[model samples]
Target: MILRSLFLSTVAAMAPLMAPVSSFAAEPQLKVELSPSSPKQGESMTVIIDPPGNLPPSDASQLTVSFTKSGAALAENYPAFPLDAEGDRYRAIIPTSPLDSHGRTLLQVSDTIETRNLAVWVQKRNFPTQRITLRGSGSGGATQYELDRVAVFKDLVTPIKYWNGIFRAPNSGRVSTIFGVRRYYNGVFANDYYHRGIDYAAGYGSPVVAPAAGKIALIDYEKNGFRVHGNTVGIDHGQGVVSILMHLNSIPTTLKEGDLVQAGQQVGTVGSTGASTGPHLHWGLYVHSVAIDPVPWRNQSVD
Candidate 1:
């Protein structure tokens, strides 16, 4: 009886070890969620991904995303970054242009274990036309040098995210021109012209504040060759979100590039410095170098 009892104890101890090796392996678990499931044209979309339990925190770097529209591939594969320090979850922002057709859009999120394809319905948005006549002749377009200076940093992706909540209005004046408005410059229909940013009818020298916390990426003046983007100040709000303040009257002497600024902090004053018909402020918000409507960003916070 003693021997039988000892044998039973030994069998129970060995039972788990004798089971199949596959049982010990971790099961596949990769979940994805989208905010504002049905996105609209000129709006930004956020992709949240929860990696499998077995993947290490560093594996989040390996995650990649590609987009497809109307059976054709869109841009290059975009990388996903860890949203938290633990690396359990990741995030990516997809920017929609004003010209992107409204229809079914497909996105594929892939990892080591499995690849998930997500279908997104993009809603259509109508934009109005605005005709403007410059006081003096010719197009006051930005020079190649000025365009290059601003273009180099627009799509840069910083590792850290500085914004936490909704963005505030930079100036307290009423909006003059909304974004995405087609333009007839001087009565000749300018084929590729659409209002890229919002125009505020702020008086000369009105306080222009930072909409969100960020690092000052650029500060330039008209004398410095910023012909069209007169007296520009660009703040990088990390993770591909950037704010470009153009036609400013002045930027604080103490404020320089790479300086940290808080929301509502005074960075410049409103003015019609660059190609101005009058004194006003032009604020352009960009994601991944693509300018989208700032109204959605002002209404809700991105998680």
Candidate 2:
């Protein structure tokens, strides 16, 4: 006990004379942000990263991010795209609707050096029910719908094209039906007929505009037989982001497949062409094939 006390006293006395033990270097500073930070289910979330001032410009694109939910990795090693010349910052999109695998999803973002476990919140959406009856081209059965979704989901050809500016609203009218609403047809609940797009209660001749720049991927009247989606125009806004304008009375005579359109350009006029109950425009936005809420995308730039 005496020796132990003497040793402690000697060590304390020598501490001032000895150089202090080295400490670890400070961690790098990274500014990470998520927009629509508290996203509801079926919405898209964006992650923006701003690295420390000392980070190299060449390393900007190398700053990859990983996504997780409930401690499980949702996406790993996903490349973050640089938005500007300096390349000190980056951005990536997380289309949460298609992540149906997560029963109770908690979106997260993490890089090799930092983590944001509570990056965003995904809330449950309670939607009201709507009933409709089909006639004419809209009379097709589930077989056609199954086939159409299969087609649209396969349009992964475009490289991710950064949106140049804020997306504009297709129709200037009020929204009649919100996205992801439960549906009933012929007095029976239809599991397959969720309202996958936003509906605008426009008049029969109301004009619809393109929300962003892209080529016309399809102007389908026969693929699914005008019944499921009447006189539809699917715009491929490069990089797997697509926008669909449906229930058109007619596509512009000047507009054709493969034609590049500018944002806010006229695409079609509204009508109850297919199985629609009344004159309205159904505007659907998608990442690949998964439907996402168009609300946030409007007045927002992907760039």
Candidate 3:
């Protein structure tokens, strides 16, 4: 009788431990859906997660999402949600990197509640550029030209918060010239000129949209006395993410300095203005004056 009683006590002690393990083994029921599985570089997509009805509405911040791409940089906003009173919706913006080409990509989203994965393919485009000779017709013009180039570089270091978001594409087109591409202007071995912006090859009058909502910071007509950039607009998207649209045919009537805008809103049209030789758009993205390539943001999965 004494031995039997001792065995019963030992069994009771181990039962509690096994009960917890079995409870954890039960996977929580959940579901995830992504909109527009395939998108061009510099685009935004939505991700929705449906949990079991028994689970109460939870904060999205507790969840995590990430992306991985071969030969491409992944840029995205993380844990973005909770700004509204209505809970259960989370949003993020993804930007593809310049090195990314036509190929497969991956996105992974997980949390204590559930895990989900997705794969996507990127489209390819060929961006072309040609060299042309620029000559000074006036005998004294060469010296003036040298001085002008110096002045522009001097002001390049002035840091400014022009826009917000991780970074976004100014428009859609095959990337022609990437940021940091060396250039030789007039055989002078122009200063390791990195293409500060991503060039898009498109027809004239192609609609150029604002990458993110922000206020117009500057609109100028003349940069080098030749009406360079023709009509240009800069929007400060907050947090130092600035978007500059150059070679614009015309600015929208509703847009002006200090005017508010939303992401994907039409701000101007493409044109062969200023220093451009053909009809295209020069979309520049700046982070506090540091120029970054916009190619990577395309087709990025938002966190």
Best-fitting candidate, measured by TM-score? 1
Checking candidate 1 for backbone clashes, the offending pairs are none
Model 3's TM-score against the true structure: 0.47
126 Cα displacement, candidate 1 (Å): 0.4
Candidate order (lDDT): 1, 2, 3
TM-score of 2: 0.71
Off by over 4 Å in 1: 1-28, 54-57, 70-72, 132-139, 185-191
- TM-score, model 1 to reference: 0.85
Q: Number of backbone collisions per candidate, in order? A: 0, 4, 18
lDDT of each: 0.81, 0.67, 0.55
How would you order the candidates by TM-score, starting with the best?
1, 2, 3
Q: How accurate is candidate 2 locally (lDDT)?
A: 0.67
In the range 51-103, model 2's lDDT, one tens digit per residue, is 76545545654465555543355553344666566767777666766234323
Residue-wise C-alpha lDDT for candidate 1, range 118-216, written one tens digit per residue: 666666778888887868657767888889989977977887888879998899999999988887877987667768888999888999999999999
Of the two candidates 1 and 2, the one with more favorable TM-score, higher being better, is 1
Model 1 global lDDT (CA atoms, 0 to 1): 0.81
Give the per-residue lDDT digits (tens) of candidate 3, residues 13-33. Answer: 333233223235564344445
